[model samples]
Target: MVHRMRLMMRIGRSFVSILFTAMLASPAIAQTYTVQAGDSLWKIAEKTKAHDVTVHQMIAAIHENNSALLGADIGNIKPGMELAIPSQTAASNASSKHATQLLSGTGSPFSTPTRNTRIDSIQKKISHIENEIEDTIEALTTSQDSFDAMVTP
Candidate 1:
């Protein structure tokens, strides 16, 4: 009888473990958000605090998860447009992918210099201007001193 009871206890423990594991593996359910009169993607994202996702990430997720419903330009979503908010993980992944693509792809036409390069260039221009100003001031000072000497009795 003791052996049968031990087996039953083991089975119960296994069942509980299985249930717990299933719960953990379950995916987060996606939610739907309807656009309000003055609702923007950012506003909606801010309102829906799903796992602390950012507005940009939320916008990307909405665009990707509901491409058919939202259309290509997620920015052009009108009032009363219903959007499907993705799970946190899914939204994060989609946002990351979108950002990567934007950076890698031809998003901007004009080429921008690196931060360091731009700073260095600005510093150089400032240095040149300062040198020119100093030269002008020195020339003016010398001219004034000479003029005063010539004028003195």
Candidate 2:
């Protein structure tokens, strides 16, 4: 009887250890946030800082997790959209990608890569791009005018 009791105690300890290990190994379940009126992805991300993610990261994570619901443009998000709040690591990665975009001047509406950029540099870049676009449009309009003039009676 003593030997049997010892064996049962050992088995119980093993079972408890297995249970504890499994609980620790399980991944954390992500939380969800529903979009509200006048809410932007930036704002939602700001609120989700409680989850320990930066606003930029939160925006990126929300965009990635809800691409189907949000469609292509992050700026196109609407009221009542349900977004998944990603884990901290995932949010960090997303924010990194967004930061890259910002640095490359491909910023989304919710975020500008200019967070670290000098204000004067941003203005100059914007001015340069605007000038290039205007030149292209003017050239195109001139070519069209020439074609019209030649084709007319």
Candidate 3:
């Protein structure tokens, strides 16, 4: 039982360290592009094809990243609107991540699931950490009680 508790504590610490590292290593600062007059999403994607991704993929990524600014109708973007353009590698990774979540039955069916998916994942992690903390507290209380009983005699 003691060994198991030690292992659990170690795992918890490792998980926290990894989570912190990932937070620090957030995706590189996204490049921002300002919409120009008479420019369509397709045109922007084509002109900014710095990565190997297809025009469709680039447009989807740009829309996903800037959904808040683009609003419900991405096609209605106006001139001077700045959009965050994610790298192709980042876009590809996000696409694959979404696919994996869908395959695992944990993804939303909506076209834009990036924000929701991240929130769900973070919530799940928080729940798991809460459970682990409760377990650790119980174990520590039990150990303290055992020590007290032995000393009182």
Overall local distance difference test of candidate 3: 0.68
The CA root-mean-square deviation of candidate 3, after full C-alpha superposition on the true structure, stands at 22.0
**Highest-lDDT candidate:** 2
Segments in model 2 whose C-alpha atoms lie over 4 Å from true places: 1-22, 25-27, 50-52, 97-153
What would the per-residue lDDT of candidate 1 be over residues 58-144, giving only the tens digit for each residue?
A: 756766777787543434557888788877777666655563332233363323333433454477689999999999999999999
**Model 2 lDDT, full chain set:** 0.71
- Which rank order by TM-score, best down to worst? 2, 1, 3
Assess the local accuracy of residue 149 in candidate 2 as a C-alpha lDDT between 0 and 100: 100
The global C-alpha lDDT for each of the candidates, from Candidate 1 onward, is 0.66, 0.71, 0.68
Poorly placed runs, candidate 3 (over 4 Å): 1-27, 94-153
For model 3, residues 1-153, the per-residue Cα lDDT tens digits are 999999999999999999999989996676888988766665676677556676656666776788788654445567999888888776654554543433233555434334434455577689999999999999999999999999995
All-Cα superposition RMSD per candidate: 15.1, 17.9, 22.0
Q: Relative to the unseen true structure, what is the C-alpha lDDT of residue 85 in candidate 1, on a scale of 0 to 100?
A: 80
User: Looking at model 3, which ten-residue stretch has the lowest summed lDDT?
Assistant: 96-105
- What is the C-alpha lDDT profile of model 2 across 1-153, one tens digit per residue? 999999999999999999999999997887888888766666677788545666667766777888787665565656787788877788877765763453344655434432323443466589999999999999999999999999999
Higher-ranked by lDDT: 1 or 2: 2
Q: For every model shown, what is its TM-score relative to the native structure?
A: 0.48, 0.49, 0.43
